[model samples]
Target: MFKYRWVFIIVPFLMFLEGCRENFDYRDASGELLFSKDTVYLDTVFNSLSSSTYSFKVYNTSNDDIRIPSVYLKAGADSGFRLNVNGNSGQAFSDVEISANDSIFVFVESTFDLDTLSSPSFLATDAVVFGNIDTQQEVALVTLVRDAIFLFPQRENGITESLPIGVDENGEPVSIEGFVLQDDQLTFTNNRPYVIYGYAAVPAGKVLEIQEGSRVYFHEASGILVQQGASLHVLGSKSNDTEVMEKEVIFEGDRLEPEFSDIPGQWGTIWLAAGSTNNRLEHLTVKNAVIGLFAEGDPQLTPPKTTIVNSRFLNSANINILARNTSFYARNTIAGSAGQVSVFLAEGGNYELLHCTIANFWNQGPRSLPALLISNYTETSFGERSTSPLTKAQFTNNIISGNAGIEMLFDRDEQEAFNILFRNSILQFDTNNSDLLQNPLYDFTDGNIYEEILLNSDPEFVRDAPDPFQLSSSSPAINIGTADFISEAREDILGNLRDQTPDAGAYEFQGN
Candidate 1:
């Protein structure tokens, strides 16, 4: 009876333990980790160009840390494209440290040309793999295509190429005065190489006429610095414009701002040095410059009048006009984009604007900085000159728009010291914001009194889509203007003379 009771208790205990084990064991399995998105494949073809450029991006969307060791293009990794990871030679870019669920741009560019790179075939043939190690896991990214637009673990490479100018070899100077290219209009071909290092001091008595359709390319450090008693005759027309191109001029150096030494004239400024004066640039297109024109220092002694007519200054980093005491007569000019101001009134510069367009200028772009800019740097006292240091400029019949953020800033109570008279001008908003009709004009003394135009109506333009500055028929811009400060103005952008009353702004609607 005792043995029977013991056996019974032991059997019941074993049965209970067996039931609990089976209940917890449904199934056990292992799964592979998958990428959030599918791999990208491409067939990139670069035609007509000797070299090509490419960029990519990388993303991390996991809670665990992702470590990238290297990246490489399987096919001809060392031949077609070279890995410049953090500016070093490695298939893997950098040891990127991305917080969980964060991403960054990873760029790749080719060092050599891939003549027949265009289809998925190219990406497949040139497919690359990234090696990453995280928590002792060996992971491989096997791309599907021969050519691919792969976003990997790397930062975009901003490598620059330099133009060869006079350094090891002696350079030649084009006679600014007597220097005449056989063709009135010069074109840059593979041959006919001439570099103007330092300054292009003009020779006296001869007018250096640059005909319309003429092209002038500058080395990074190459520029024309007209000395006193010298002049430049830039002849261009609305139909045929003269081109002063910044040939491969970039503004990146080891220093804060680029110097002339690394790539001489890389800054690419058309500086009419203080002593240099009496220059003429008309119907010209000056683009991609550090400073379009810098007229600085010794205003009292510089040339009396400097004329810039019908010129387009596009995409400059700083002031288009850095004039001082220099009498400037500008007409039908366009200054915009990343430039400090269309014209910088520094060191007491005197200027007159007629039918000119100044808009979309400030510190913003790939080459940009964060700083509020003043429209004109008007000074009440520049040096010891007792002469009205801050002479008011006459901006008659001009279209100054899209620059609401910047104000006509004053220096030492100078906004009231002098005036920036805007007669028959239109302060309008850009298309980016349609409801707003004008710029936020202001004065230190006036405050909101002259803040902006309250019309709030569309200034129906001739063409409203792209360049909407042109006025339409039945528009308010016609014959609603002020009298001329110097001479009675004539000829609008359409070549129509001023009527009984001039238009409100730079353009008068001929169709209207």
Candidate 2:
């Protein structure tokens, strides 16, 4: 009798709970759907390149569960803007339901071909419609797209044309997706922005001259390879306005968005082949590359094969300037923010850096290397090593500072000729290392190498500025440079004349 009474009581309680449940049958309602933002700006992108995704919330604030029958783009089926309604990606979506007081995300992205943009940049706009007819609600979508010259390898018969770079370990031909630039094709003008898909190799005995104001953008793994007997002459003139870099020739990634402006390793590098010679860079700006300049070749010590004057290499992934058995004379140049090293002189090289700043504050990850590395040996993929004599490495009136305690590493092989000197420069050396202190390379008594060097001294660089290597007013680098470098780099990178007691690094510290 008790069991029967319990069973009757449980049945009534279950029926009572069912009566208080929410209504599961949702009805399609026609009403205004509120949005988190009225307009979604997807930032700027090059023509034919997709913009970053931007999202907005569609909130159903009313106490009624409704179905947005038609969530679509206003431009219909022929629109550049792509839409994703509640994780379903397409040009249009139907039956987008939202519960009461709940929200749904609508992601928007676009890639438009502005065959005839009125100006250099034009706005590409669209709207995401929520419903049909009188109950329509929308969030406008806009993006600025600029026209670019797209360059990629031509494909025929399922085989894409490629440029012959060198040989593999087995002496087989190694190539990259590119074409050998020769004759009239060598000259790159400022007519339009060039976007490179693969490595553009300069033919032997040819010259690839990039004219002033030319902007050359590289895609993934794309760069310029200077071959033997070839030259890369970047003849960019200084801008009249010192504040902005307008007239300089720029070589960077193809991304135009502001977020990728300073990010590193967007593309490959300006690779100088082992026998390439007579390369010059003036008033050039290279940023966001794996290696800004990977040079290995004739170490012309006297005249210096490669001259980098009034140029900047910023935010490189590996090494800003990696010279192996090559020679470089960088005057009034800045190489900073590298993952490995700002300037890596490996397998021997003749390097003369005057009035330059080499800093690597790699806040992106844990950097294990220094800002500068000078070595007399390099290894191959098979661990086979090769050696060369470091003829000379001179750093005058420069700054080498980074997050690493020892901002410079000198891996000198006693068998090879290792000659290096740092005069009138602020360094980040730690004298506490007994092994380094005892090494002849760090022997300060030999005035020939470590002359007038300010070890472990802070240059007091300007923080949160575009050029983080710029000297602050009360910097130890002020009025500490030697006058010997004036004949080589009289003017700073910005055309500021260095005085007798000039400040160190690329920028001359001007007192406020």
Candidate 3:
């Protein structure tokens, strides 16, 4: 009788505890619901495309735990917006509970079909109404809908569209989700932003031209591939005002959220493949790519048939440029922060970089490679090694630096020519290491190779300036560049004139 009595009391107590946890004595959420954001502004999304997920916090400021009677979108089921509350995604939620002084999250996203709407508006607006008319509390959701030229691969019977790049190491045909550009689509103008879902190839014998003020947005793993005999020309005229980049062409990831702005490795490279001829990129800005630009092999023996001027390649997750036995020329260009080498000229070829900055202050991860690397040989995966002559690696009025001692490396095959020169530049060649003293590569006193180089010195990129490439008044890179060889890029990246005594790097020290 005593044991049965104890069991009866215990069972009732357990039921009451369980009720308090799930169905507690909850008060109706009234005037005490605090919200993290009154308005949740989503990223600019293209027509018929879902946007980045945005979230807001809903807090219960009351002393007693409360339950909201209803949480729903104002338009009910007729809205394009979607909401998720407490792991449930729907148009409306009921009995949403929040602990006293605790908070819960509400996520919002949208995919608006502006093409089908009777009255398509640029700004899409909706509100999440909480409870009935008597206890109404709401938060506004705003989204910017943009009309873009959506270029994506098509789906066939079983396979999506693809482009043939080359043969793999196993001698199998290698292809990716991509498509070759048609004759009519050879030119990308400044009218609408281009949103590419896969690699867009410029077929052989076709020329792809990008006019000024055009924005090219890439989805994951998407890029531009200039095939052999195809040329890519980006013509961005200089702007009078330095504050705005209205005249420059931009290539970046499609995510327009502020948090994703500087994140690297969002897309693939703008690859200028082997035998591609006469490619030019001027007054352009490339951001957040696996590799900003890659030029491989020469169409002919003429070095510097491809050129980049007054351009900026920034925050590449991999090498900013990896040129394999290719001839290249760049002036007033910036190869900024990267996870690996900024400019890697492997299986080397002729290269000239005038008034360029290759600075890697990569804070993302461990960077084993140097800021600049020059190799005269390439070792294939099948244990085959081939050597190529590095005819010329000339750098004048350049700044090559990083956050390490050995930021420049030279790998020679002994028999190949490794012609190198640096004139009137700031180089980060820390000679403290014994290996540097013994190597012939760091012979800074040799006028035949290195002349007037501020070796192992600070460039004074302002006092802890956010942009490490920006020059301060006391920068050693200023008034040190030789203007003898400059022909077209007399104006820096900022449109500031590189005077007779030019400053190194892309910008010409516009001190206010």
Candidate 4:
């Protein structure tokens, strides 16, 4: 009987200790809640589209545990924003608990149709309010919404058809149906930015003209295709030379988020199909694409397949210009920052690049290819190899440099006619490598063919800053180009007049 009495007393004492541990202080008047940020800025999004989730932390600075009676958006359901408190999502959440000296996260996302709003371009703002406290803490939400013409592939029965490849040998249209721009849609103006979805094809015997100051934005895997007998003319003038950013035609990915601005392979290539002719791109900027330009042409045509002057192809995931058995002329063109070769001439044909810059300083990832690759033979996917005669491949007054030890590769077949000339050019070749030095293909002493070639010298490229690919005052490529080669296009890429003895690269060095 004495032991039973002691047991009952001990049991009651244990119960008292449990009660003290379970007791949590819930203070409503204390203002001890802190936030990670006062405002969270979402990336720029298109109307009627949903934005990625943004988050913030709500800290409990007080020593005691607190229960937020209500956490709601000030704009409520009418606002374009949505909030997720802790693990629950709603306009208003109840009893959000935060332990003492601990914190909880709150997520935010937005989806709104700008057409229903007052203006196409507007700032959407909302506030998250924490109630039940004498002093409430709020976090602001802000987003910039833009209105764009979203062009996507046509869907039939919830299935997107594939793009048409080309016509077969029988002249019958091949492949699946695709979005083709009509005659009336050939002209694109600067009234608004165009956002393409899948490939936008220009039909045969048609012409697609992009006016000056037009901005063409392509979605993932989207690009422009000029079919056989079709042409694409970008008519951007130099009237606003002082403001090149506003006057030049721009082609890039559709994502306006800051994180995706410089990402490559966001879009496909501007493919100029076989037999396509009379394509011209002037005073333009093409960036962040798989292949900036893929041109194939018929050697029978006397005129060049394409002419690109005073244009820039920057940050391509693959080759900037992949020419396969084509004839083209480029003057004052800048092709730089590519994952693979900057200018790849495969199964080579007639090609001339005057005062052009072909560089690949790709810091995004590992690059194993050279900046310039010229080959007279090509291997198919099935291992079938074929060789074509290289009629004329000239690089005059050009700068071919990159991070790779050997920035230029020439794969020529002895049986084929490989006529290549590098006149008054700056080439970044690996001179230390005995194999490269002994190779006759890269022999700088061949003055009969490779005349006035500057090898392995630093061009002093202004890589980081206001204008990249420009030559600094201490560049060795200054005043080294042949005057006759630069006379074709007297103006540089930046509209600066080239002197009688111009520089090697696309830009004329303004020495101090």
The per-prediction tally of clashing pairs is 32, 0, 0, 0
Residue 290's C-alpha lDDT in candidate 1? 71
Best by lDDT: 3
Choose 3 or 4, whichever is better by TM-score: 3
Runs of candidate 3 exceeding 4 Å displacement? 1-4, 13-32, 63-67, 95-103, 116-121, 242-245, 299-303, 463-468
Model 4 Cα lDDT, one tens digit per residue, 1-512: 99999999999999998677546555552566889999999998887778888899999887877888789998987988988889998889877888778899999999878676556578889999986656677889899988776667788898885667867656798764358887878998876677888888899899999999888898888899888889999987666355445677999998888888899999998989896789999988999999999988664456788899999998999888899988888999989989887999889688889999998899999998999999988886667778888899888999999887889988988889888899999999875877767778877788755999998888889878466999988899999999995557788987788889899989998765
* Span of ten consecutive residues with least summed lDDT in model 3: 112-121
- Model 3: number of backbone collisions: 0
Q: Supply the TM-score for candidate 2.
A: 0.90
Tell me model 3's lDDT, rounded to 2 decimals.
0.86
Better of 1 and 3 by TM-score: 3
Q: Residues 280-350, candidate 1, lDDT per residue (tens digit)?
A: 77767666567777665443433445677767665666655556545566776666554455556654545
Evaluated at residue 299, the lDDT of candidate 2 is: 87
The segments of candidate 1 whose C-alpha lies over 4 angstroms from its true place after superposition are 1-207, 240-267, 297-304, 361-388, 403-406, 412-420, 427-468, 472-476, 483-488, 493-498
Q: How would you order the candidates by lDDT, starting with the best?
A: 3, 2, 4, 1
lDDT values, one for every candidate: 0.46, 0.86, 0.86, 0.85
